[model samples]
Target chain A: MTLRKRIIACLDVTDGRVVKGTRFVDLVDAGDPVELAARYADEGADEITILDIGATRDARPALLDLIGRAATALDVPLSVGGGVRSIADAAAFLDAGADKVAVNSAALRDPTLVELLADRLGSQSVVVAIDAARSAPRVWRVRAVAATEETGREAVAWAREAVERGAGELLVTSIDRDGTRSGYDLELTAAIAASVRVPVVASGGAGSVDHVAEVLEAGAAAALLASTLHFDILRIGSLKRALADRGLSVRLPRPAPSAQQVAAWLG
Target chain B: MIAVVDFGSGNTRSVLRALAAVGAEACLVTSPAGIRAAERLVLPGVGAAPSAVEELMARGLWEPVRRWGADGRPLLGLCLGAQLLLDGSDEGDTPGLGLIAGRCRAFPSVADGGPRQVPHIGWNEVRTDSGAFDAYFVHGYWLDADPAAVTGWTDVDGFRFPSLVRSGSMTGTQFHPEKSGPTGRALLSAFAAGALDARVEAATWS
Candidate 1:
């Protein structure tokens, strides 16, 4: 049976804090990544991706620890990206128990890095990160890991090529719409999904349940969201029901309330 | 205590919050020692199966958790955590904990034709006896399980995939309970209530 799409929550952790913003500006602090991850987990996030954002080995170790702690405490898949440049970094994250290590700027500098990673970590362990945004002629270019470097690459082709070279999945984000809450760049997402053979996780913009509906309809295998979930504006149940109403096939968890959900349970 | 096994994946805090939200005395522990100390265990995991299993091995939680599940403690695996409950997984060639019998792997993300993507993400309906319930999914691979063993299923891309599997005391779901809204909370609450076997009212999709 074909697996239903997933709703992933992106936690941008900087110094152990969950930091998020649109276009990487007007950032706000939600809480500790661990705390925030837990909150989302309770809220029913399908998957949690922790992008360290900062590029450092120390941070890598800490992130791995976080991953280990998360793996033990969580019941969902945790994807760790950011600041990863070498096999060592990927290994570290995996050693801490990450499902996949996402590579962006590092792979762009050396397209072969994706292949190398696939060889070392296996393609399933390597996730190629594509931060896509429109450039001249409405062309899509990938923003590097930390938005530092620009690559002369096409996102749709990049997705196809990465999978061709053994990359397992594509985690593509729209830099323009990141944190915009306007919605996902379904146009770009759909375009890339068409070009890729592997699973493409549409990231960058997700403001509401409607945005999620738009992207899933646009053909994304999954949609990645940041910030939207933290505020409780867009919830998993509502989104799932919304998608179901639109005829998407998803699994609904039993809506059993915890004792604490009852005010009287506090006593 | 309903134990949340800590393997350092992501959102340990979040799962605990979920457990707390459900009014389960959720305790986060990394070692099998703590796991053995609990009445029930929630083996929540994310990231890679092999690595997660590796860490579980490292912490010496593998055997005990298996034994715990064997001894009638209700074990719930979520997402990758759920995937690891199987016999084998395609991600990283890792052998699952075998608490539940099945091979877990990623299928072709999209059907052979059209422009669909992989890692099927987002929310959809979970069909049940009462009616269809809305929930979320976020993974490339699903449980390739025997139809009888699959307690829950979802249709995607014209294919039916197992979404939840319950074998004895072991219950697992590919969806995340913490991220799911009211319905998800209800599901977890039911599990906590020890009523996972019963189907609830047909939820109106938002």
Candidate 2:
């Protein structure tokens, strides 16, 4: 049994509520983060990533209370990101019940923070989130601060550096494809997965289960879905079934009893 | 009570939460006294092996833990906790409790023709005596030991490694059952319910 391709549900949280946006702009409120996360876990999400989009802008910490609530409700691993500037900040999230702490802007500012986080809270618990946009035909550059700032560093190179610096996993989001519902930037995801030894989670532009299949086939170890799952355009169970039918390994939820089976049990 | 040894590593809170979700009476055991009084011992860890071992020693837990397993008590290890049960690990060149006869080695990069990632971080299926079930994994190194000692195995990138192992009263899992959804919750619930005796019997028969 090879490591199954993961389907992670991302909650773009602002304040205490889960929200969604198109290319990191024009936000729309979805629901409470805890409630949505619990639902996703029930629906068979392999993992949950709660990215506090408002943390850095407000200079506030990641929603510790919210993470705690979600952690209680979720049996799967929960990864929290945003506004994690120091080891203490990352520690705070882990203490609040996060299995992993993802750093983006902080890591770009000081690459050593990656080493620190890995040193302080095991490499398995440190995830480096890279937001990238297409810079050239086949090249992508890293974007920081909610995709508002360009770092000029190439996406693939940064991914390799992050792994070298001690990030156990890389959550690579394509700014150009984010929330576009077209599909993932397969080329971009493949490049980073190829360059690094850590598992790469391909984020952005998931319109259909087929799109997820495409990216996973292209070498992404996991797929992060936000808009589609939040808006009810796609159901996680159906998507997992589709992937399983396509011969992709997925952690399918226990099958619900059919009416006949239920009747027999009641009888 | 199920005492979860807290050696200042990562993910202890989540482990506690998972235990609670399964309705297991669990608590964080931070000292040697806590270990001595516990009905069951759960060694939970996540981080470098050296620091984990250092913290355990600093807290005066190293000897008690080894003794607890030696006396054939119900002791379970999770992730780094499981790695530390072996003789030693290449991770940080740290020594383990040597409860099991093995050493931890890093996962190979070249498994088949493709490049495999380290820290096998995700959910994967594990084959055990009970059945095949999915569990969450996050580790760079796996136990290199005799096949007879392994209770369960998982295949990744064309390489098969021991995901779960049992030696007398000591059982360890490389994957985090607390983070592995329903199947994981079931495993924990069983462990809390005196299933270790059944495991011992099964091992003896096999």
Task: Assess each prediction's global lDDT (C-alpha) against the native.
Answer: 0.73, 0.86
DockQ of all predictions against the true structure, Cα-based: 0.19, 0.33
Model 1: per-residue Cα lDDT over A1-267, one tens digit each: 355677788888887788887797777887777777766666666678888876577665667778877755555567898877788888778767566789888888888888888888767668888888888554788777566467778788788888888788788888888888888888788888887667788987788778898898888877888788877778876787788788875544454445333111111
DockQ for candidate 1, C-alpha atoms? 0.19
Q: What TM-score would chain B of candidate 1 score versus the native chain B? A: 0.88
Could you say which candidate leads in TM-score?
A: 2
- lDDT score of residue A37 within candidate 2: 92
Task: For each candidate, give the TM-score of chain B.
Answer: 0.88, 0.92
Instruction: Give the TM-scores of the predictions, in the order they appear.
Output: 0.64, 0.90
Off by over 4 Å in 1: A119-122, A230-237, A250-267, B1-206
lDDT of 2 by residue, A1-267 (tens): 688889999999987888899999999999989999999998999999999989854535438888888999998999999888999889888878888899999899999999998887779889999999998899998989999998889999899999999999999999999999999999999998888877899999999989999999999989999999999989999999999999998989864333333222112
